[model samples]
Target: MENSIGIHISQSALFNWLIIFFISIFGIRDVLPQETTIKTDSHAVVSVKASLLPKGLLGPIDISPAVIPHDQYPIEPQSPMYPSFPSTYDPILTGRCQLNFSNMASIIDKTASDCSAPLASLVGNVICCPQVNSLVHILQGTYGKNSGSLVLQQAAAEDCFSDIMSILASRGANDTIPGICSIDSAPLTGGSCPVQDVETFEKTVNTSLLLDSCSTVDPLKECCRPICQPAIMEAAVRLSQRESSPLDNAKIPGKSVGVDVLSDCKGIVYSWLSQKLSLDDANAAFRMLSSCKVNKVCPLQFKDPSTVIKDCRDPPSANSSCCNSLDIYISDVQKQMLITNRQAINCAMFFGSLLQKGGVVTNVYDLCNIDLKDFSLQAYRQQGCLLRSLPADVLYDNYTGYSFTCDLSDNIGAPWPSSSSLSSLSLCAPEMSLPALPVSQNSRASGGSRGLGLALTLVLSSLSYTQRAIP
Candidate 1:
């Protein structure tokens, strides 16, 4: 309660400060009394010279000290003016980056706006971090063009990464983006991966196979089929073995690499890919690759379920308490962030098991009338949209800014996990109320189900998702 009060006070103070700054820069003549005036020292509120001001939408006018001590004022009142980008404002560049930043104005502007300091913490997961990741991947390809090598040397990585942050900050992006996105210059430097250059990476890994597998992604089933992920992992493992002796290499054919080593090598592989593919293709492939990681689990954080357990332990006897307590808990959950429908299912099952473990035997979701969309940040609560699992990304344009597709064709009931336990529950598990299209669509008998019939069924089963723009 105190925290909420503090936040409200902080927001009110911030709004008041912004209003003052706006008034000082562009004098609010209409709001000011016609006969009223004030006298103060330097950097204080002064008068506006309507006649002397630049004419015809000349942009933000500088409040020169010379304009003060005006004798007569215009009798007619004017509307409040506002500030905008200064005429001479330009991003301070390091002049070290080989990539031409001028060519990337649109994306840079998009990233700057999306990842601005005021907005970063609020939308980091859905907006800011995604754009930051995309920008880094795009920069990798662009910088690789002139350097011939996709990955940068350590010194260059330091300089270029600094320059990237400087450019974004000058354009009003969050300076703490590295921390916000958990990124560093390490990826640009290719991490601790032994293979940095293209020639050695090609010689060590099956370049042709890697390229063929990931050049294009089938969005619908890439998460399930996982053609590119394994290929990337295999390539990363082979690349990680560059420093190993021939004997160890022979013993570890297609063996798994350690966690850190595998991640570093994957970054190296992605750099090598940037050196080969166009920027658009690389960015798309990277988004698809990222989707594979986010597809399996729920991103929303869950709190302790003690309150829910106590209130929801009994069924019809405790209906009012159970539903009331559940609605409160779910409201808190929904404040986490927007998530996809597939992720929502996992979240429901996971949370249900938590409740079941805490002595809540009954399915509270059925009693509380919880929907799948209830598991995510619902802007419209009773009728809000939840995102689709795969084929999701932040789309940007001059007009639309950033947006993502959302499933809005009515809410699906949050499936109550049976007493069968969470381990036995799978998306492909039958006897469940949720959709099950089987694990392998291609392995169907006579290849008949591999056609569009089952695919159409899969599409219709999930209903429709629309592009929802966050304000």
Candidate 2:
């Protein structure tokens, strides 16, 4: 009987303690200030110029101070802006990926800016085009002064351009712009335009030639110059990988001549072509280009004492066919067009726009094997139409032909073939549910935590009163 009585008293004490604990916690919550819980279930945008929390727990996060300003550049109030290349749009000459060019260019531009810092402060990562000039200067200061063979010089230039292009292409896609095969048709679209007919390239090469020219320049050079000049220098870096030329019988001993860079240039550039050039096409081109080496066919090959083989004299001149062949090899069959598509999407998305608006079409479905239904095609078409209205010179400069531009942008507004509508798309992944937070009541009302604390305190006080009343 005595043990039972003691057990009952102990249970009573424990119960009272529990009640008091709950009330104290609630009371503490009531005394605390209310807090707002921001639930980011939807897309939440934070601007670069936005003010931060007084406690400094939250703020507009700047990832690369070298590129983006913390409190400077106003978050573009409307949308991201894409790079506007002043030129005529050409499909065949620029590789049917006009959209990629515009979009990728924009992304590169933005990311570059993001990585920069105030001049008064130490400069950070130089990412965008404006900073690319500095990057070039830095690189030149490091390597260009050497008396290395021209092949090395060219390779160095090419590498730099490819790096920049790759960076731009990677960062351009977003919620506004579609992903691969979303902005345009897939590579298969290139197959729609026969590859066997190099006539387009032949014409472009002929047009680019300045009568009896020893070489041909990119047709889009006029428009792409603003963009391509940097790209070309970067691409020229492939020259650095060249092998020293074989010694000629009459030339000075222990001296270097020209260099060939690629181990399999001829094979990748010529033998591996298919119906539609895939992304691998760029890889192949780069492989051949980076492996450029000295051609042994010297005097017969064009005997300039400099074995660089970049130029040929009239007597041993390369036939115009060489330009035609090269054009077909570089522009016609290589996967540069596919890359352009990827780039365009990246650029357009950076600015909350579409390629069709800029008068360029990427054939996302045909080129990237993406289904139309997987994305918002109607939205993209609307954006494309807007892009089409931009300055014509940007189009002409970037694309070599007006026909190419029209084919990409104007046709976007045309009624979609029933087969290609978004409804027919089957590649979309299922959307996931987002988390939600409790809705806030009156701003002046106690928050969840504070209310809980107050209730806890009140419960403790009540429990104490009840204990005294019960005993």
Candidate 3:
């Protein structure tokens, strides 16, 4: 029984050992492929995703593949991936886009109210209020356009207000006239305004000298009104102050100088009008001055000399014959002047000894009558007045009474006249006295003489010509 029990135990133990061996073999087969995949994936993740690692963790990590050498892979400097921020203070980005007109009007109104109140007691309520109101109207008219910055417009308005205030302060301190605001006041009489004061003020402000100077040279005519008007007003205020009486203690005139009644308050009215004239109006006034004739109602006098130029440009009346005769005389003078100025320097040098000496006036018109027989082409050429080859074609139209062709082809082999001497040449034949050269075949035989004659004619002409003033 003992032997049989031992055999059973031995068989059971062998079966248990066989079961353990098979379990071990299958477990290793399943785990081996998974472990290999994990190792391969971890190596690839480290190589490709290394930049994602934390800063401290990256030092211990070796991300490069074992098979690839570390030196083969170059480390490139990394640049930032986002754009840089823009400046906040840039004008294009920060400048205001819109303007508030109502707010601007309010500012102007406040400025006018402040300046006008103090001025009212001095110049009277009518004159002072209108001045400030006019300024407000001007500001609205000037900057009420669609475009322009509010900042710049405000600045311009402020400058205008400052100017107005300055004018008011000056007047308030100087104005001592009581009832001197009345238009009916008499000039030089105590508290009386000058009747001709308007006319005088107009004459002074629109002086012919000032008008002529401004028209030709003053580019600031558009802005001159503001500066000039105030000056005239101040002058009028002085006139009133001079005329004001200390004995008469009359109250301030309730009846202010009305627009239509300016003839009575001429000084003040003209002063105001001087500043408000448009460019067109100023030009018209200047034109009127210029159009004044010597013997006409508005003669060219000390007050208006511009009419002298006007008579030159256009006569006042369409039927006026004064300028027509004047124009002919002027043309003759200009032609003579041109002839004198154009004489060749070499020509002047050649004939300098032959010219009349002393203070006697030389008449260039007489130069047209010089005898060609006395001059020679050889002498002219020696003075640098001739060219070897023709430089340009001479137009027959430019030479009066000479219809023959004057170009290079017409006179080959002949030395051409220098362009610099053409003006001298014109003087030589001023009356076109040279007989027309023959256009037929026979003309070629005399071509040499004609060419020589032309040269001689020009030289003699220049020698004979002298400077003379036109009457």
Q: Candidate 1 — worst ten consecutive residues by lDDT sum?
A: 452-461
Off by over 4 Å in 3: 1-197, 203-206, 209-238, 241-251, 254-276, 279-471
lDDT tens readout by residue for model 3, 355-431:
22211123211222111111211222222122111111111121231111111122212112332433343221225
TM-score, each model?
A: 0.66, 0.18, 0.14
Which residue pairs show backbone clashes in model 1? Answer: none
Error of 3 at 267 (Å): 8.5
User: What are the per-residue Cα lDDT tens digits for candidate 1 across 386-427?
Assistant: 665554444434333334456633435677777675666555
Candidate 1 lDDT score at position 99: 67
Runs in model 1 with CA error above 4 Å?
1-89, 103-123, 169-175, 244-259, 316-319, 380-383, 391-404, 421-425, 428-471
- Which is better, 1 or 2, measured by lDDT? 1
Residue 89 accuracy (lDDT) in model 1: 40
Compared to the true structure, candidate 3 yields what TM-score? 0.14
Q: lDDT value for candidate 2?
A: 0.25
Highest TM-score scorer:
1
Native-referenced Cα lDDT, model 1: 0.66
Each candidate's clash count: 0, 106, 1
Error of 3 at 347 (Å): 70
